[model samples]
Target: MNQFVRIQYVFIVALFAVVVAVSGCRSSTKTYSPEDVVHYDESYDASDKKKIVRDLVDPLVQDTFPLARQTEKPILVVYGISNRTSEHISTDGITDDIRMELLKSGKYSFVNETQRANIEKELNYQYSGNVDPSTRLQKAKQLGAEYMLTGTLRSIEKKQPRQVRLQKKTLKYYSLNIELTNIETSLIEWADKVEIVRESSKPFIGW
Candidate 1:
């Protein structure tokens, strides 16, 4: 081949090799353990859950309000927190962390209502006579929940109007309202909420 033609061919071949190499390169990923305090974005995350748990459960237990009329630890079933946001956020973490904090305070006992079916199955199996009679659990002897802990997670988002700036900003307001209701009286014994406001800016063209 002519010198110029050979040079052009080599340049095209080198460009193709570079693109193929880039395309074949593996993408990188980072993993954070549960103990890691990492904030990848301004959206709701583990840090927010931790803050909510800390701010939420601490005050409830510290107050003078009687969580239970009796002297024993109140039996509480967490019905779950309803998510009233446009975003598909998982509120399970919020519920779990709050329950954990409440338990740590030694102020309440929790009943896992989510495992009703599994518990029913186990109880039925134990009563079916296949297991030892001494180990069999008594029927209809499960402790009833004296109080229900339920809440709702609400969020409102506002974006800045179109402007000349290269970065666009978004404002998010989040509120978590938690309530303790007496099962017999159908009254809210104690209620409180925690609010968070977050502002984030990102390039308009990309994240």
Candidate 2:
């Protein structure tokens, strides 16, 4: 009986050791803040978005643009920023940042085009007499935006030729051009461009 008990204890100890080894071998993840500029490959990163916003917003609010010419805050509708690049990028992030910056400047007011359908639904409900007449919103009284803010993002990528180089190099150029256009006149009142160039390299041989 003593010999049998010693064998059981040895088996349990070995199993526990195996479990510990497997757990130690499992991969671990590191967390990063959203504001940190981390680059794992040759792609658009947080730094690019930050720089683009910085470069573009200042120009739009400068004296050369319509900011100085107009005293009243302009109502704006952000149509969208079209993505012409090959990669899958959420272009809304770019436009949203720009919109936030403009809002902070207190020179522009925005119409929420994305929520127009829901907005209409609420208005229709209110008009159906379910709510008090004094508290209900009127139909067809919504303010029209005077100008539209939109633009395009484009990228050009170049790679090293198929030579026997020790490392492969890729160069990417990105450009973002934004414009504020008058809805009535169809003329561009303000425009600015942000350009970024990035290069990345990878070793040819595998370890």
Candidate 3:
């Protein structure tokens, strides 16, 4: 009788251990699908843009400045940037980045758009209904801008789908097109294009 009781107790303990082990194994299984994971590295670096612009624009501006030394200081103004891409990109961010780089080079002085607008408003107000031709001419001369900077951003995307593996890979290409124009002559003094590309792949585990 004693031996039978001991054997029964051992059998029950072994069954309980097996049940707990199986439960733990099931809980340890990963739940997230591979497609839920995002894996793309950003192409733009804070320092890289500044370095690229400075390296490309500074020498050109320095070489060009001697020709316009007669002016108190050649003021360059940003006209605007056109987005030729499908993505909703902020042109101001890129222009501002380039502006900061050029300003740091100290080869050219830029007129802020806000300041230009204010000056324009003040000039129009003071000259309104005034018949004095000299005053109008002076105001025009005071507001003259020497150079203009404009640019565009373009993008291209490509995708490859692997039906057998249920996976997709995507590639994105970005281009920044910039040009410096002489406002007086309507001539482009400098033009440069910077290109950046990024690629990513994701696997779909679930149907």
Candidate 4:
């Protein structure tokens, strides 16, 4: 009887522990907004950078076609932006932000460069023996981009030696340059740049 009672007690304790653990885990889980700024630092932040780039590119593209040509949105493909900065910055993220902004502005249509392989595979499958010929899409009917959008992100860092001991300062200048070029004419239609500067200083004092 004692052994059976001990087993029942152990089972009850384990069930209670599991319930408490689950409740604790559920309470610890959190959801954060993309626009939320938790903390600021000297280094570049992804969310902050996205916002800045979006603001910089929105107006430039909004007026690209003018008021009359707004209806005739041009097709654009993101050729890609190179990250020439010292740190590991997400050029893809910046490109995505710019694309989203342009999309929201309804100024241009975008081609998915990252999904080219998948798109081709799907097209191939549709052309295979499985899919119905009547429903299959025509070959070479895909819309080609009229313009290519590309850019580069570069940073210049400067460090100054202090005249006195235990004093130093560093300045980082970040620049994002974006250009849109006509594929057929080989002419740049639009070009713009955005800059951000961050400065860090250390004093001869304790924190």
Residues 1-207 of candidate 1: C-alpha lDDT, one tens digit per residue: 799999999999999889877775569998777766666555888777888888888776774756633479889999999999877888888888888888887878999998999999999899887999998888887789988989999999999999899888988898999998999999998898999888888887731
Instruction: Quote the positional error of residue 155 for candidate 3 in Å.
Output: 0.6
Which window of ten consecutive residues has the lowest lDDT sum in model 1? Answer: 62-71
Assess the local accuracy of residue 171 in candidate 3 as a C-alpha lDDT between 0 and 100.
Answer: 84
For the record, the alpha-carbon RMSD of candidate 1 to the native fold, in angstroms, is 5.2
10 residues in a row with least lDDT, candidate 3: 34-43
Question: What C-alpha lDDT do the candidate models reach, one value each?
Answer: 0.85, 0.87, 0.68, 0.79
Q: How far is candidate 2 from the true structure (C-alpha RMSD, Å)?
A: 8.8
**Whose TM-score is higher: candidate 1's or candidate 4's?**
1
Better of 2 and 4 by lDDT: 2
TM-scores of the candidates are: 0.80, 0.80, 0.59, 0.74
Question: RMSDs, each prediction?
Answer: 5.2, 8.8, 11.4, 12.5
> Can you tell me which runs of candidate 2 are displaced by over 4 Å?
1-36
Q: Measured by TM-score, how close is model 4 to the native structure?
A: 0.74
Q: Which of 2 and 4 is the better model by TM-score?
A: 2
Encode model 2's per-residue lDDT on 1-207: one tens digit a residue.
699999999999999889877774558999887667777667898878988888988876676776634788889999999999989988899889988998888777888988999999999899887999999977898789999999999999999999988999999999998998999999998888999888899999842
| Candidate 4 positional error at 43, Å | 1.7
Most TM-score-accurate candidate: 2
